[model samples]
Target: AQSVTQPDIHITVSEGASLELRCNYSYGATPYLFWYVQSPGQGLQLLLKYFSGDTLVQGIKGFEAEFKRSQSSFNLRKPSVHWSDAAEYFCAVGARASGGSYIPTFGRGTSLIVHP
Candidate 1:
């Protein structure tokens, strides 16, 4: 069985400040990892994905994440966050059942609050 857990339910940061969101997953084999941002009332947009190779992956909107195999974690980071980035962020892992077939599973989501 594969499962993802995001410790934070919400976060607040000032505009232009750095941001980091935590994520943890449980799986037997290395699974696909992804970060998605969803604006109010909108669907999720892929920020980045770690399928294979390169533990450190860059994503859209100047976001990046580093995969730690031993820790069973993939955490998202941004140097400077914009107000537009103040939305809900979800950390997910692609899980498969018995075979190669996989489905996307998301965390509870962290609501980002950008203080003006």
Candidate 2:
């Protein structure tokens, strides 16, 4: 079975500060990892993903992530935080089911709080 874990439930950062949200996963094989952000009442928007190729992938909104197979981690980072960046972040792992379908399992999520 594959699972994603986000140890931090909530994180507070001062505006304009760098931010890093941690994510770890356990899967039988190489998994498709993703980072998504959700606004208060909006649907989730994918930030980035990793399937293969370069370990570091650039994403929208000045965000990027590095896929570390050794550590089973895909942590999201932002060079500078903004007030509008306050939202819920989720780490998900996608695995192929027996039916040949891609099933995504999401982490509990980490809330970002930006302080002025």
Candidate 3:
């Protein structure tokens, strides 16, 4: 199955601290990588994506990730934390399947707890 997995279900980060959320994917030929953030049950906002070129990709809201083909991993990182950043983060894989559009397979999700 073309899927993505996020091992961490929950993470707590202090305000103004650093943050890193891990992500791994199972896909052939280096699928599109994306990191999305959602507030509770709300819609997901695309944080970043790695489609073709650059191994190191930057995204909105001061986030960046590196695609490591050898390790089959794309990890999301942020230099500093904000209380508003507290939300559920999901790693996804976008792929074409049998004439259907390339859609994302989301992770179970990691809930970020920002402590003030």
**Which lDDT tens digits does candidate 1 get at residues 53-96?**
99999999899999999999999999999999999999989987
Per-candidate TM-score against the hidden true structure: 0.94, 0.96, 0.94
Q: On residues 71-95, what C-alpha lDDT tens digit does candidate 3 reach at each position?
A: 8899999999999999999999998
lDDT of 2 by residue, 55-109 (tens): 9999999999999999999999999999999999999999987887778899999
Q: How many pairs collide in each candidate, listed in order?
A: 0, 0, 0
Pairs of colliding residues, candidate 1: none
lDDT of 3 at 93: 92
lDDT of 2 at 3: 99
Error of 1 at 114 (Å): 0.4
Question: Of the candidates numbered 2 and 3, which has the greater TM-score value?
Answer: 2
What ranking of all candidate models by TM-score puts the best one first? Answer: 2, 1, 3
- Candidate 3: which stretches are off by over 4 Å? 98-100
Q: Model-by-model lDDT, in order?
A: 0.93, 0.97, 0.92
